[model samples]
Target: MSLHFDHNRPIYIQLMEHFYRKICRNELKAGDKLPSVRETAVEAGVNPNTVSRTYMEMEREAVVVSKRGQGTFVTEDQSVIQQLKETTAEQQMDVFLTTMKQIGFSEKEILDLIQKRLSALENGGDSNA
Candidate 1:
């Protein structure tokens, strides 16, 4: 997965979230080996220590498991994965609403924007066409 870090938060936290989302989305499945810390760090342009820390945190959360000589793999629990996805979606939606409110967008305006964006996306984003 390609990870982009911003100034708002630490890179390790973003890495953890990114990996969780990937697993929750089934992009990474049970027994699927993850990239090495060095590889991921190089790919994400971050320090290996950050990636290692993120993976360690994920392991502690039971989102991933590591084998002694093998690599880290995504967990196999369907319920846990589903719950994570649901929670992530809800959290993202809440954040979106909060940001909209902060930007002076009313509920109706936000709903309209969502509809428009969905429609545009469904129409291949060719609004003028």
Candidate 2:
């Protein structure tokens, strides 16, 4: 429920990202009940319809399943979560690539920089140090 919303994107997209992270991180485990739409709206400081929209989208994506009278729950299918993980990775890579290109870095330069940063991270060093 703790969300730092960017004013750029739609609030519903932000909400969906929050849920996606929670599920991938195992903070919201398989079969765990989602916060009620009203509860999420209150916590997110958004309209109830926004929460509903996010939940509906998640359901359509098979990330969560809504049962009548039982509330929405995280999907029990591990493959769905894995697919989501891959999708998140692709989206992140796309963003990084776009930013690097816009900043005048070529693909090779970006890859080299990413390698260095990853090596620094693995060795517990700061890449920007």
Per-model TM-score, in order, reads: 0.77, 0.88
Q: List the residue pairs that clash in candidate 2.
A: none
Model 2 per-residue lDDT at 81: 96
Best by TM-score: 2
Instruction: Compute the lDDT of residue 45 as modeled in candidate 1.
Output: 85
Q: Give lDDT tens digits, candidate 1, residues 56-108.
A: 99888887888888888887877777878898999999999999999999999
- Cα lDDT tens digits, model 2, 43-83, are 98999999999999999999999999999999999999999
Residue ranges of candidate 2 with Cα displaced over 4 Å: 127-129
Residue 98's C-alpha lDDT in candidate 2? Answer: 93
Measured on C-alpha atoms, candidate 1 has an lDDT of 0.86
Roughly what TM-score does model 2 have, to 2 decimal places? Answer: 0.88
